[model samples]
Target: MLTYTPPIAEQRFVLQNIVKVDELSGHNVFADVTSDLVDAILEGAGQFAAGEFAPLNRVGDEVGSKWSPEGVTTPPGFKEAYGAYVEGGWGTLTGPTEYGGQGLPLSLSSVVMEDLGSANMAFSLIMMLSPAAVEALKHHGTEEQRRTWMPKLVTGEWNGTMNLTEPQAGSDVGALKTRAVPQGDGTYRIKGQKIFITFGEHDLTDNIVHLVLARTPDAPEGTRGISLFLVPKFRLNDDGTPGEFNDVRCVSIEHKMGIHASPTCVMSYGDRDDCVGWLVGEEQGGMRAMFTMMNNARLNVGLQGVSIAERATQAATRYARERVQSAKAGSASRESVRIIEHADVRRMLLRMKALTQAARALAYYAAGLTDRGQLGDADAQARVDLLTPLVKAYGTDVGVEVTSLGVQVHGGMGYIEETGAAQHYRDARISPIYEGTNGIQAADLVGRKLGLEGGAVLASLLSDMRAGAAGEAPLMALIEDCEAVAGHLATSSTDDRMAAAYPFLTLLSVAVCGWLMALQLRAAEREDGDSRFLAMKKAAARFYLDQVVPETRGLRAAAMAPAESLFGLDEEAFSA
Candidate 1:
């Protein structure tokens, strides 16, 4: 069985030291979210993850989820585990108080979510869509819609899903052809086949609320015509209990490479013209509404990446210490010793630890800013807007990188399916593809976010990074390099800027992560704690600064490369 230990201590260090979450005390909105309460929540969440979810991960991978005409049947223990999760109130942590939620700060939500992800990436995804849905409803749904749906979804008794992709419209959402025709009774009839819908047909909940994207007749072409709709698996009766049988059906579920336990359904709605749907937000406003949730989901996906890396690090470190190999170089005896004693093995372990810690710190920083945004900090929201793509792209890319290193650390054993190292690698491969492909994230960062407020958002963020890394030479140097590249982009051609998008996102992410570690190193240097943990923290920071931070130089070079670099190899030359 695969083993995972939740890094709750590291989470606390980030919360109390780097995030300084205690300062949110003045905000009445978070008045009840004391440090003690937050710690207790993390503690309980960690326990639940390790004891319940961890055991089911391997089971989920082997058995996956089964489907039939009745609906989706999850692997053994999933239904019971989800019931326990709701009973423990895990789902309602950051939800609104008017509903069944506890109204905790978003930073706290980030902390618990990391544990869930580390425990079981596939299992956690079942409920991941709900919180994002809650955000969408809170921001865009009608008052009656919130009253009718928020409670059940927030309580975790009912799950939520986002349906944006169709057979022809993978990431090009503007090309979707699903239609929602108004029937004149305030409801619309939806007709379309939506694919890649995660947890679309699951037995874990009593009912599922699907947020579907479709075009209305007389609407304009392209994304301008898109509108959002709320289509439930089962229609609600006047008493608010599920009543009529909806026309939505799961035509089939895909056989995926990773996250097999997560049912990715191909749903066909209105097969018999009975799929009742209600409009959300307004006509021609689906893109605006869906982004409300998609952005949040992007952040969550980044955390998924961080969680798997952390888990892989734990497994690798454990395997290194236990797996004996030939004696270290120049050893007095020829007897075998633990692989951890080998220099290259130590380097690999440190690299894994450094990458995971840096990525984790970056994620928590974004989450803390998101919490501040909730408290009405306009500047913080702007910062979060800038950090979202960095978190999603860099974080997941690192996830794939780190998990692959886990397999390397295991040697031959890692390739064996029973060892489970390969599963982490397989699972992480999808993170970079889902939640708006990292390429799109990079494009958004370069084309959209950088221009926000006439470029003040990016400028303000660089200023903050400089302040945070005032005395840290490496981080400061990276910040300066980033500033120069960003400045150059203002005069660069559209092709040049778009060509630089991916590298620019990566450069900014690596630099920001370095800044965060510098802040963490300074804090650990001044704070009182176990000498070993503090020393380890400092070493991790130094490792990232010395090793990972240098990647920015390469990123800047690639990002600033001539636009012709990519197009020079034209239509006829490539295939030959």
Candidate 2:
């Protein structure tokens, strides 16, 4: 069995030096968070994830979740482990202090999330979705709604689930048919079926709060008429206790390829035409409100990719070190060598490490940006917005690649169910597809992020890269190439520009990741001791720049080309 350990030191370095988390100390919201406090939190979280959560990973996968006509039940020990997690205050790490939360910066929370995902991603989804619900309430809910739900949610006494995807409507919200008819008592009667709802109806919590998207009776056709609602599985009494059943029931659970312990439910609302729900925000603004949670979910999904890749890398690296195979070429002795001694195996392992580290840096850097957007300097917030889509899209895409590589490194064992590497590969597949697919993320990168402030954010980012080079010959050459690409991308017309958007986004992500790694290398050089850390950073950065950054040349050309090439490709050519 593979034992998972988080690279906490690397995470801390990224948070402290690359993202400058210390600067957030002065902010009113972040005044309580200090470096020592954050470190302590991470230490405890790392230990718990490795010791407690990780042990259940294989067991949960083997036993899986059992679904009956009554409800879904997780594997044994999950309930206990989750209780310990909540008791430790891990669930409320990033919630607002006013609502029974620890009020820590999301950067710190994200590090903990990475560890949890590494241990067991299916288990982590429960906590992940709850905070998302809290965020939605915090942003758009009425004062009454906040007062009623925030404390329970933030305290983890009750869990939450996002109810968006239905059987008929998966990605296209416009096709949703869930109906919420207005009632006389400032509530709505909701009737619909929701599928693939994680933690949809679990016995782990006292109650489940669902942030459901449904259409009002008067709602116009399409997404414009969608409204957000707060529907609880168990109704709350006047004294804040669990009351009558709210008419929400889980009809079935999906038989998934991975993450079996986490229930993916098909829930039917208002089977009795009595499911009561409260309006979250103004009527017909559900899509806007949902974006608040969607953005967070998207970023976290990217972290899922990072977490799985890290776990897979750890497992593969350990296997390579212990598994003996054929001798090296031209060896005098016939004794077998460890697999890691083989050139091909080393190459595979190195690629795994390089890609995983690069993705980690990117994901953590994005977390820092999210924190900065909320608590950093003005210019920092701008950079965070620009990088959000790239981080979410690119990081998760890389996650699928890296985790897949992990399985490949294991050879035949990787394909077998018992080896566990296959699970990482399967779980990671959903990350790039869900929470908005990578393609949608690319579209968002070009459609919204790249065009922000008429492209000033990207321009400023390029300028910062140039400034970071500071006349160093090697760095300067890379900076000059990146600038040239940026220049070409900047001048392209809209029709021609759409053709380049995806590749441009890819280039921008690789360039930014390379820049961050380079900075890490320089900082590691100046520090005393920990030469291994610095050396690894330098090697990873070198690999990224030498191998990965060159891909930008092709991306740049594609972005700068006329639109005809993409649009002109015959549809029939894509057929077999």
Q: TM-score for each prediction?
A: 0.98, 0.94
Lowest-scoring 10 consecutive residues by lDDT in candidate 1?
550-559
The deviation in Å at residue 122 for candidate 2 is 1.4
CA shift of 355, model 1, Å: 1.1
lDDT of each: 0.89, 0.82
Question: After TM-score superposition, what is the CA distance of residue 132 in candidate 1 from its true location, in Å?
Answer: 1.2
Which portions of model 1 miss their true places by more than 4 Å? none
Q: List the residue pairs that clash in candidate 1.
A: none
Global CA lDDT of candidate 2, please? 0.82
Residue-pair clashes per candidate, as listed? 0, 0
Per-residue lDDT for 393-414 in model 1, tens only? 9899989999999999998988
- What's the residue-level lDDT of 362 in candidate 2? 78
* CA displacement after TM-score superposition, residue 222 of candidate 2 (Å): 2.4
